[model samples]
Target: MSTIIEQNQSNIITDNGLFPSNEVMLDLKNLKKVYPTPKGDYVVLEDLNLQIRKEEFVTIIGHSGCGKTTMLSMIAGLNPISGGRISVLGKQIKGPGPDRGVIFQAPSLMPWMTALQNVLLGVNQVFPHATKAQRNDIAKYYLQKVGLEDAFNKRASDLSQGMQQRVGIARAFAIKPKVLLLDEPFGMLDSLTRGELQDILIEIWNKEKITAVMITHDVDEAIFLADRVVMMTSGPKAKIGDILDIEFERPRTRKSVLEHDDYYKYRKHLIDFLEH
Candidate 1:
């Protein structure tokens, strides 16, 4: 991983050597978000700007309450922005739509629904124009893709936490969203389960070719999954403190990414700001 300082170096390994702001897909310009608090205005973001290109996995690493999740909520149109603008494919995003899919920290599945039915909810809502057969096929395909084939008939309440998250991933993918937003999707799982799910998510991302932005506190997970690791500063109002380019080859394995020359350097860099 290449840190903020390393980005200044001309020879940094970028995709076809493209610069940061040149090939943009989703762009945020001078975004500022403030929340109403008893203590007055609590600003989360100030003059924050970012540009994400097509089909890139961008992972954001920050301390708690650094406003990383706030930024994602704004981008997903789940929350209103206090100022500035966010554009998706050059169009203003004013509200939540099927084009942006979010996998939040918790599974948030309906207790009364089965795993298969929960996934079908997204299919029903997003692909309302399609036939019943098509919706069923899509939902089934996504569930199987996430390794939940056997659990398809199980109720959400009956599944384990890991199993529930798998269902959540399948459901999010069922919509065929243009962008995928993940908020600590693997944080709740055990080490072995976490690795397995990470692999599953990587496979899904490769097959779908969807643009993904994830907010994670896990340094290892950020480096393992993302094309670039974006670090935020400590906040009342946070800005981009660092941007790290991951130089590991495609289809990155845990051992390979860890063995890379700059891996420890990157880890050390991120550890510094974790104090906040």
Candidate 2:
């Protein structure tokens, strides 16, 4: 049984032990992953366990080859788990579904299609029963939310990288997925562009309250975006080494966070883990 936790208004732990919420939106139980090599099986992750609550933002961070992306793939149903099980909202995750949406480092919009068309494609597939008007509305709303209302008709190839990624974000949210998976979604962007997209993502997340799991290498990004930062050890059989619950107040500004002592403490802790 999972232990219960008491949360203050700030979500800072004033008393009691560290425990995940009772309402688990996603559960990974003793999860394992192994790949068959020419010589033998190469295990990437073993005995991995984690529980995420509904609408919670969780980020996984570690050194390279730590299986962070691999773990995200498993959750996305893109890869098969060698052992253990993944449950999403009490349903077993056997394969991909409209319930989960993934955004990768690169914007995956089709070069042939316009931003509106690209977003509508996924929304249409996910909600096939909806009328054309409804689907159009859904796509446009998300696009507008991501600050791409004027660029709706722009082709993916014509748009800037950051703008293209905005379309991807719009497309993912248009599906109204229960869970959102992000794999270094801003890894290639400039610092200013990355910050802009991060703010957009945060705004969407706050409004939608969709459960999110992201894989990232940046400690500051993980700290700013995650409700909990899960640190993994190095692989060939990597597993979670630590889980740090972020105690920062919501509507968090970058300036405020940087000035806070707790932020540096959290940053230092994560950096130390990655270094040694």
Candidate 3:
């Protein structure tokens, strides 16, 4: 049995057996991933556990092949878990659901679809009850929010890399997902474009207040966007190495974060973890 308590305007669900509190949006318990190879079973992640609170933004950082994407895909229900369980709001994840939205390394938009059409594809699915005009407005609003107002009718194939990603961001957010899973969404963009998109992402996240988990190899990016930076140990059996909480106040800007006294300290810690 589970208990629901109202605390400080937040619903905290507690089950003496499993869930600790309702404030927890995503919970991963004793998670494991194993690949069966002819040589033997290759374990990628073992005994991984994590909890993300509602509306919190967490970033995962690790060297290449540390199983960051594997963990994220499990949470998204895109991949099968060999052991343990993943739950969102106390519901065990079995497969991909609309409750989780994903932005991959590539935008992954339908090239033949116009930006508006691509976004509408998701908006329509999520808001099936919304009237035609209402759904159109919802899609347009998010597109404009991501600075894609002028690119609304442009085909995805015709858009620049940065522009396509903007559409991806807009599409993911427009669905009003409970969790936004990002797998190096900006990895392929130019530095300037990446910075611009980061700002856009943060601004929208601030307004939307969605719980987010992102994977980044860039320490600065991990620090800039995360409320907590989760470090992973190097793989064949990668697990959480450490977690660093970013204490800077939100509605944050790159300029403000960079100038903060703890900025370099946080950067050094993340870099040191990756290097050593």
Candidate with the greatest TM-score versus the true structure: 3
Which residue pairs in candidate 1 collide?
none
Model 1 per-residue lDDT tens digits across residues 1-276: 443445565453333344444345677878999999998999999998777877889999988899999999899999999998988776779898889999988888896999989998989999889999898899999999999888888999999888899998998889988888999988888989989999999888888878899999899999889988999997888988888878677777778888888899888877776764
Q: Which 10-residue window in model 2 sums to the lowest lDDT?
A: 12-21
User: What TM-score do all the candidates reach, one by one?
Assistant: 0.89, 0.92, 0.94
Model 3 over residues 1-276: C-alpha lDDT tens digits?
Answer: 022443534534454323346678998888999999999999999998888889899999998998999999998899999998899988898799889999989999999999999999999999999999999999999999999888889999999999999999999999999999999999999999999999999999999999999999889999999999999999989999999999889999999999999999999999888889
Candidate 1 is scored at a TM of: 0.89
Model 3 bad stretches (over 4 Å): 1-20
Q: Write the per-residue lDDT of candidate 2 for residues 153-206, one digit (tens) a residue.
A: 988899999999999899899898989999999999999999999999998888
Question: lDDT values of the candidates?
Answer: 0.86, 0.88, 0.92
Better lDDT candidate (1, 2): 2
The per-candidate count of clashes, in order, stands at 0, 0, 1
User: Best-fitting candidate, measured by lDDT?
Assistant: 3
lDDT of 1: 0.86
Clashes of 1: 0
